[model samples]
Target chain A: MIAENVAFGIIAAAMALGALGVVRTKNVVHAALYLVVVLAGGAAQFILLGQEFVAWVQVLVYIGAVIVLFLFGIMLTRAPMHPKDSLDNDLRWPAAVTALFLVGILVGLLVHTFHADKIHLNGPVRTADITNDIFTTYIIPFEVVGVLLLGALIGAVVLARKD
Target chain B: MLLNEFLILAAFLFCTGVYGVLARKHAVLVLMSVELMLAGVNINFVAFGAFHNDRIGQVFALFVLTIAAAEVGIGLAIVLLIYRNLHSADLDDVDTMKG
Candidate 1:
């Protein structure tokens, strides 16, 4: 239990720093790289939570597919590889204040409500059980998500095609 | 092991994403921030699910992953189109609809 707590603390701190880098970095590519840290940390968090399937899925989907897509967008759009000052808008201060406000409220509420609660990571979640749930209880949503993916694919091709 | 640990981490991530979305001038950066927010939500879901010993949270996290992928696909497509048209990826530069 102490080991798990230490692991979680380290990973969570790294993720927080990575998340900050994602938002605060001057270079777009650097921001993307920072995202990789946060994403990998998320996978670690999932493992610590005893959800191995989701952790690997996160690695495959977010780190693999999504980050690649972001790179393509960055390259195709020709974002400056070097750091720049104009990446932020004039509303930066206001946005930071808003985000800080949210942090105070959310963190306060969560600690107040769940401060004593502990997650019992008894055993790793079975991938087979997740599959069963998806196919049986969540069949409708699963199919809907499939349809959504198909639609998104078609829409992307259509929207990105040259006239 | 404390549930608040995960929840607080998620809240911090979510707020950072919000700041990114609101302050970033680039469209792709905004999309990336949105991804951050979704990731935070996924953490919350998985944490709650684990706390309760339920598989539903894992299932929902999978669904969130699928949807996030689709969203990135479509969002990048739109950003590409905008860049192609305006020759710029800055969100402020694409205000043709502004009165």
Candidate 2:
């Protein structure tokens, strides 16, 4: 119990800090790297919840593919390495206020709804069980996601390819 | 270790992403912010799943992950197209469509 709490605390801190870096950084590549940290911390949070399969998938898909895609976009678009004033717009103060308001509402709602609820770390869901359920009950959505991926691939190639 | 703790953390991340999306001028940065928001939602899904001892939340998370991947792919492609045409990724500069 103590170990779980400690792990959760550490991962949560990392996630928050990484997220801060992602938005606060002036350089685009640095923001991407911070995003990697935030995503990895998210995977750790999944592991702490005893969802190992989801944790690994989070790492593999997010850190492996998505971040790489962001880097490629950054590179191809020629994002500046140096800090630039143009990265943020004039609405920074208004956006900050809105973000704070959103955080306040969400945190208040969560605390009021589930403050006393405790999650059991035992009974970890096996990958096989998830696969079985995916194939059985969630089969249609599964197939739809596959089709979505195919469409995204074709669309990306068509949009990105040079004439 | 409480459910609210995870929920609050997710909220923090989500809010940061919101700020990023609203403040950042670069289109790629905006896309990255969207990814951050999705990550926060994924945390909420996993937390609720574990709390309820149900596998459905995790399954939904997987679907979210798939969709996020596709989103990033197509979104980046579109960003690339914008950059090629405008020679800039700044959202403000892509105002040719504006009357």
Candidate 3:
């Protein structure tokens, strides 16, 4: 239990710091790299929660595919590698105030809702059970997600192709 | 770790993403921020799913992941298109639709 707590603390700290980097960094490439750190920290949190399959999927999809695509977008668009003052708009102060307010409300609500609850990590939901549920109970949504992905692919090709 | 801890962490991440979305001028960075927000939601889903010992949260998380992937693809494609036409990825510069 102590080990789990320690792991959670460490992962949470990394995630917070990495997210700070993502937003604060001026270079787009640095922001993308920071995003990778945040994404990896998220996967670590999933592993600590004992959802192994989801953890691996998080690593594979977010770290492997998504961030790579972000990097591709960054490079292809020729975002400036050096720090630039123009990376942010004039609404930084307002944005910061709004974000802090949202965070306060969300954290307060979560604490009020689940303050006494403790999640037992021993009884993890297995991959097989998840697959069964997805195939049987959520089959329609699953197929719809498949179609959505196909459409996204075709749309991307069409939108990105040079005329 | 208590459930509140995870919830608080997710909340922090979500707020960070929100700030990024509202403040960043680069369109790709906004997309990255969106990814951060989705990651926070995924954490919440997995945490609740683990808490109840149910498979639904993880299943839903998978669906979220799929949708996020598709979103990034289409979003970045749009970003690329904007860049190709305007030669700029800054969100504020793409005001051609303004009245």
The Cα local distance difference test for each model comes to 0.95, 0.92, 0.91
Rank list by DockQ: 1, 3, 2
Candidate 3: segments with Cα more than 4 A from true spot: none
Candidate 3 global TM-score:
0.98
Q: Per-prediction TM-score, please?
A: 0.98, 0.98, 0.98
Comparing 1 and 2 on TM-score, the stronger one: 1
The parts of candidate 2 lying over 4 Å away from their true place are: none
RMSD of every prediction: 0.8, 0.9, 1.0
lDDT of 1 at A12: 92
Chain B of candidate 2 vs. true chain B, TM: 0.97
DockQ of each: 0.94, 0.90, 0.90
